[model samples]
Target: MSGTELTVTLSGATAADARAVVRVLEPAFGQAKEEPPTSEDVTVHTARFEHDPADRAAEPAAGGPGHLSGAVTVTVQGAPEAVSMARESLAHAFTAQDQGSVSGDQEQEWQLLLEP
Candidate 1:
């Protein structure tokens, strides 16, 4: 378990930020929760964009530019802290990287921001 806070920010013309966020948050979910300082301990993810880093990334992207806004919130599933950690991992990874959110929201494309 990693008690140390890990916050990585990515920027690019593409949705690279989302990809980067999910990548770093995966381990927290994949690991066992029996150990201390595990996922539930403090592992979580926040989603946001360049322009609006306060609200959750909304509507995938809609269809435009000159606007940067996204969603970001702490997630925790039922069970142990690890479970919450896993949820956060899923939320972050599943948000922009997963096909569900990406493929489903293709009408508009937006960047992602994952904060730990």
Candidate 2:
């Protein structure tokens, strides 16, 4: 992925719950390539977002009123700045707890637990 691209992974949640989280992030990063859950038994959903710094809105949009059944584990992977921006966006939408994160030379991975 590019520096401005972020990959969001949601696990231990239903498809609807995953979509709710993606909706919260759409405004900050624009539309994302969302991968629908493969089957009813599937527990993981993924979305890819490309953030354009030049086109960012002055004020990020607030998350919608969609509700989740339970807490969702979210994993965001991207460049350091991209991951940070995504974390901030998720915080504005849900009750997020910082789990932990790992950083490398060109990329970073952050894990968060989000509650409705």
Candidate 3:
């Protein structure tokens, strides 16, 4: 199946999906032309993170307003080599023209049950 290819048309994506898509934006636009007024009609032919480290659900949870139909998560368990490639694509979409200061951590916890 590695020989096969898939395309993700991010044209009509909902706001929630846009949030998730932003992670892969950088690399997505790296190859596109730089024209006046950016085009939100972006497509990421190559995405990186299939099995999310966070909720493991890149798609919106069931019963949500923006549940992606016919949507499937690309499992990376079989091929560990694709992770880096995917990340590279996203980096292009995000940074766009400017390789801005990117220094942040993806935290797993955000609760405040106990005050430290």
- Top candidate by TM-score: 2
In candidate 2, what are the lDDT values of residues 21-106, reduced to their tens digit?
A: 78888888887875545465777888898877677664556665547889999999997877888888888788889999999998
lDDT of 3 by residue, 1-116 (tens): 22211122333333344444433432322221222223345432223223332423332222212223223222111122223333334333332122122222421111111000
Best-to-worst lDDT order: 2, 1, 3
Ranking by TM-score: 2, 3, 1
Query: Per-residue error at 88 for model 3, in Å?
Result: 0.2
How far is each candidate from the true structure, as Cα RMSD in Å?
A: 15.5, 2.5, 16.2
In the range 1-116, model 1's lDDT, one tens digit per residue, is 22322222233312433344344343443222222221322333333211221232322222211222344332222223332243344444434332121112212222333233
Model 2: lDDT equals 0.81
TM-scores, all models, native as reference:
0.22, 0.85, 0.22
**Winning candidate number (lDDT):** 2
Can you tell me which runs of candidate 3 are displaced by over 4 Å? 1-78, 96-116
Error of 3 at 16 (Å): 4.3
- Candidate 1 is scored at a TM of 0.22
Candidate 1 vs candidate 2, lDDT winner:
2
The clash tally of candidate 2 reads 0
